[model samples]
Structure formats: C-alpha cells, structure tokens
Target: MTQTGASRNGLPVEVHHNALLQLLTNSLILSHTTPYLSCYDVLNLAATSRAFRYLVYHTPQVFRHVQLSNVKAAQFSIDGIDRGGETWRNVQVDENLTEDDFYSGPLRGIFSSLRRQNILQDVQILSLDGLSVTAELVHDILVDPSFSVRILSIRDVKNMNERKLRAALQYACRESRPEGTPRLRGLYVFGPKEPAPELLLKPPPPVPVRKAAIPAPPVAKAWNTRSKKALKVALVEAPEPWYARRGDQFPPRISSEWAFTLMACHGIIAFDTVLCTGPRHLNSPAWGTVNIDALNAADVPHYGVATHSLGGCASCGCAPEGWTVWGEDNLATSREPNERRTSGSAISEVGRFPLLAPPPVHSSNIKAAMCPTGQPVNPRSCFPSSTTGKREKACFIPRCFNCLRDRYCNGCHRWWCETCYTGPWATSPGGHGGASNTGADLLLGVWNELP
Candidate 1:
C-alpha cells in the first residue's frame, strides 16, 4: 500500500475521500474556527497552496458565513476607491498578515471577490460592525440579488443613519428580495457607540485637565475576575485622586456603593459577572443578585470601591481656590497669608453639605474665589440662580431632610435639580449622573468619568 499521510499508531494514511470530507466538515471545528478568524483568513488560505486553494475556492460553505466585526479596514485598500483604480491582480495571499490583522478592516474587496467567485449567493449569516458597513455599501448589498443574507447584525457604527438602514431592511424583507434570496430572519442593532470603561469597572481616574494628542476609540479592557493575580495588578495600577493644580479643573463626584448596585441592576454597567453568568440567577429569577460587595472585597479587577472627595463650594458650586484641611467640622479657605487679594492667592474652606441638598446661601457670607486676573468673583455667578424658565431640567428638589430624597452624580458630585435629570445627556459621556424614575424621588445617577 502506498503511503499517503501518517495516522495514529504509525499506520499509513489510507483515509477515503468521504472520510476526508467528514473531517474537514466537522461541525465543532467549523463553528469554532470562523469566530476567531477573519474573512481575509479564508481568502488567504485559498491562495496558500494548490490543495488549500482548491479547498477554499470549492468549499463555499466555509467562506459564505462571515463575521466582519474583528477586521479593520485600514490594512487593505479597495481597488478603485482607495487604491487609485487598480485591478486586483494578485493571486497569492499576503503571507505577512499576523493575528492582529484579523481584527476588523475595510470590506472593500470582500463582497466583490465573493460575488465574482459565486459565493455571495450562498451567504446565510453575516455580522458587520459599524465601520465595515457604510451606508452606500449596505444599499449596494441590499440591492444586489446575489446576497441572500439571512441574519444581519450591526454594532457600534458611528454616524449610521438608523432610519435609512431600517427602511432598506424593511424593503429587503418585503419587496427587494426575490426568489433564491434568503428571507431576513433577524435584524439586530447594538450600541451606536462603544461603552466607556467606567460603565463596567472602576477605572484609573483620568489625568486632570490633560488632553491626548489624538483621541482613540474607547476600548473596554477585559478583566479575568476569576484570577486573583490579575485583580491585584489592576488595583495596584489604579490612579489616585490628584490635588487640583493651578491650571487644572476638578471633575465630577463618583457614585456611592449602594448607588452603583442600583445602576448595575438597571443594566447600566455591563459587569463581567453579569455578562458570563447572565443577569438572571440560574436557580431562580428573584434570587438573581450581583455580588458587588463580595467582588469588591475580593479586590477583583474593575470592582473597586467608588470614591468621591469634597471639592469646590457646596452651595454655588465654584472651583476651589486651594487645597487645605481647615478643621474637622468645616473645610477651610483663605488668601495666601500676607499676600494682597489682587495677587491671586485667595483660598477658603467652604462648608460641606449633603450631595443631595444645598445649604441656604447667606448673602453676608460668601466662599468666593479669586478670578484669573486677581479679582474675587461670587460663586453664584458660576451657576444659574433661578431654574424656573427651564422646563424638563434636572434639579435636586429637596423634598426631604435625608440624602435618600436626593440623587447624586457619580461624575461631578454636583446636585442637579430634578429637571436636569431627564436631559438627553443623563446617561451620556459628559452626563454621568443618576436620576430617579419618578420626578420627585428616584435616586439614580452614576459617576461620569468618561471623556
């Protein structure tokens, strides 16, 4: 018997064609392989050697179902649009492409090549991130008779016009799809933007008043909560609160531990525990509880305690002049000793009040700070004295004596009137404040640490 390929126990490989096909078409391998690879990976494999080329080109089943979420478009250029109208003449896949290259990239030649190879007609499942699916490209895909895409998912694509996309999907589901076209079974639209790190974990507080040269897309760092070593490293590297430098401005207050739990319950923060096990308890729905305290106690990564330091004026909400611990009962402030008021060294320790309720402003006593040009400005000028004209505004209307009646912001630590709670920015990047579900008494707010 002529030797083919070696088998176990040092036997000569005499596998039948059917057996070879069965090994290659194993459901477990096929399902597991595509998720960890890019469509370019299949294309590249098809060009590697004669045998691989044949396997990839002939096996439409392997390449037809693709997830373009992990690929980046910047690596490869489209023929006409990005590459100066050059035709795709290369028959070989770039051997230098690394694993990092697997992440999402442009889909310029992906569909075109698939269409030419007659693979597009058989496509049943497709997952596209916002970057891969441009409005124009989506329109083309929907209009093209070749794409029999059954399931479509779009996530975190910026500037994606939902209205037009939905309309196109509706048309494809109703009229544009003809015979041989697979009926759209599901259409899912995930987050319009990537979530901030603070939403999941207590991140290293941001550098004070510092801006990056180039802003990058938000990336949520994965934490292996199961590992204690990983958790220890993450906490050790966490940022400490910085004293306000001469030119720096203070950020918002973070939420209390109890408030964070409430936010977690509302699906605001995507905890790894919640993500892996799921929101509901396995044994009973009512028993579904996130063990935040235990996680924090264990020092698990991203589950650190949320802290808020007292800063600025409690009443007018002005920036503090200087950092000083005046007394146990009250925070102290004053100008630099022996320096004139015009020298810009005014410092004062303002009164500490409940985050929910503001203390009555006594006109006779003001904790004013010196302006940049060395002139004292009343803190009241910094915020709106009256919020009557503004409807649907966020306000911390004091309906009770306790903090329970007031919602606190984990971001600014400023107590907003109830009207400001329901504004568009409530859960947004700059607006990391909780609001009660009811106008009068919902203690809902998260710390806004997102840039």
Candidate 2:
C-alpha cells in the first residue's frame, strides 16, 4: 500500500485508520453509548469513508442494536385528474405499489441501507412493527447462528401467528453455554395473534421398572461403573430435569411463549412500554398471569402501550419529547434528530406527587427526561352540571390522556381550561340526563390510573 503521508486533518491516513480500528476493537456500544446514537451515527460515519463502512458492516466484532420503528414501504400512483372537465373526476392510471415491490422503502432509506450493506445481523432490537413480518423474516433476523438480537418488537404482520412466535422464541432462547441462558430477552408484538394453547405440556411418562434382573448392591454398582469407565465407552447421559426451568406446577400453563419471554428477561424498569405491557412480574416462575393481551391490538409496537396495572404507561415510551409544551406539529419538528430512545436506561425512580396538583416545574416539565405517567382520577366524574348561563370559551387545560377531560363534555364532548380545573365547565353532564359522578384527589395523578 502507498504510504499516504498526510490527509487533510494534518494526520496520516494510516494513523487515523489505526486509531479508529483500535477504538472499534473496543466496545463501540456500552450502557452509556446508546443504541439510538450509534445506529444514527454509523450512517454518518459510514458515509465519510469506504474503509469505515467496510469495517462497520463486515466486522463481526462491531455489533450494533438498531431500532426500526414505524417504517412503511412507499406507495406511489399516477392518476388522470380532469378537474376542468365535466365532473372533476379522478381515475387511476398505474398499478398500486405493493410490499414485494417496495418492502424496505422508508425512514430515509435506513431499512434498505441496512439490508444493502448486509448488516441486519447487527440489529439487536428489531422493531419492525409497521411491516408484514413473516416467519421467514423472523428467521432471517434472529434465528441465525451469528445473530445478536435480544428482544423483537412487531406490529400487525398478517402472515404471522402465535405458534410462529413461539417457534421463533424457542429458537431465540436456545443458547446453552451455561444452561437455560436465552439469547432473546423478550418479544413485543401488537397485532393479530393466534390463541396460544393454554395447555402446552404433554402428560408425564410412566415410571420405568427393572422387570427381569435384581438391582446390584451400591459397592457392586460402583465396581460395575468403574469397569465401564475402564472400557472407555461413551455413556448415555441422563436427561436434565424440566422442573428447573418449567417449574413443578401440577399443569404448567405459564410455560407458554408469553411466559417464556418473561422468564428469560432478568429485570425491567417500570417504564419499558414495549415489553412491560401489563403485570410483567420478573424473576419468579409464576408467569401464568402474563399473555399477548398485554400488548396493543390496533397500533404499532410502542404506539398503543396502555398504562400497565403494574405501574407503567404508554405516554412515557412512545410519545416524542417536548410533548406537553408544543403542539402536535411543533412536537414533530422538535424531536431529537437522534435515533429512537427506549426504556433501555430507565431506573426504578418515579414521582410521588398528588393528583390535580401539578409537579414542580423542575421535575415533571417536558424539557427534562419525562418520567411521569398518568394514573386514574378518582371517583371518575363526567362532571354533570345544571346552569343556564353564558358559556365560556374552550380553554387549554392540561388533563390526563387516559381521561381526555380536555376535549370531552356531556353536551358537545369538548372541554379545555388554560388554568382552571373546577371553574364552571363550559359544557357539563348535569344539564343533560346523566348520573352523578365525581373526580377524586388523585395521588401523583394515578392512570395510579393503570387499572
């Protein structure tokens, strides 16, 4: 190779390359080196140099856990629009583009770029919740011998089923270096799921009997074993007990794929919406309580994470930053250019404020890392009122997303207050034929309201 003395940065090309190679040799991804940052930065870094791109893609040691959220194949069509003619009609002139035609055509070509570069194996958190994920796709992504994915998130994949999910989970959990060490941590799906068979285990086998010969004495048995060892024959190994992992329940119903997911994971923050769908108890073998119903049925993976009864909510995970301060359009523009952030870094810390009482500006505001999730307002009131008076304007009131008290009223189903919660509602349920209900002084504003 020609020794390029120096490049533009006042450093030799070899020096720069060697420096990067050394750094890359070490872990590029760590607890603090977020997957979101690395996945985005890799594209930028890869674009800078072919050497870097080759190293990033080809180096099996350099792994990255990427997130692919809400990516949909592009669809285009040509139309014959004769607005000037009689009826202002519109007609289609081209065949509609299908998934087969444009399967990886979204999110700034990130999906296609990854596949084209042949680095799908580096993606550890696969969130293809917007596409028609199939058994084939899952196999290609996680079932490979060199794959490093831990958790998978999927949405409405019409071709997929719970049985397929179980198979994928079985393959993902097949790491046996130290026994029962699963590679895949969990599976997050929010789509059409076939019913998981509640009863997955077969009946226990009948006990074997020594029919013909009498059992040898202990010392004689040891002597016979020593004799076999002296013969240098491969001994038939005894099977490991299932009771260790599956447990000793009379009929282990929790041994389903859903249960296996929880079993594999070590621990979770109370805020990971993608995985923490419902009462996801950790560590214990009592996983019969968890199921696919915990996930959303009508939306993408993170989009519809309902507030879990076990102290979590959908708001904290999927919602973009500057959530409360900016309008929807403004929030869209203000989101970090960084790749998606998950509950990967969340800890056990949460607020403990009272309901209807706003938190301190420093703690619960949108500028900081948003942690506060809604709980249910007590005594659930539709706020029925009776007063034939001049109505007020729709104010910008801050209410929980779960209740949606801001834009829901008995009359027109609309209410908003910039500063007031109980000051003469614009439209009340009382004027109409409604029953008596009231709001409770909530604790830290429960969706403690997760129920």
lDDT of 1 by residue, 180-247 (tens): 43244333343232233345456546556546556444442223333544775575443222112111
> Candidate 2 has what TM-score?
0.30
Residue 19 in candidate 2, Cα distance off native in Å: 14
Best by TM-score: 1
Runs in model 2 with CA error above 4 Å?
A: 1-41, 51-55, 58-63, 70-118, 139-142, 155-159, 170-182, 190-451
Error of 1 at 147 (Å): 0.4
lDDT of 2: 0.34
Q: Model 1, residue 14: displacement in angstroms?
A: 6.9
Go through the candidates in order and give each one's C-alpha lDDT. Answer: 0.36, 0.34
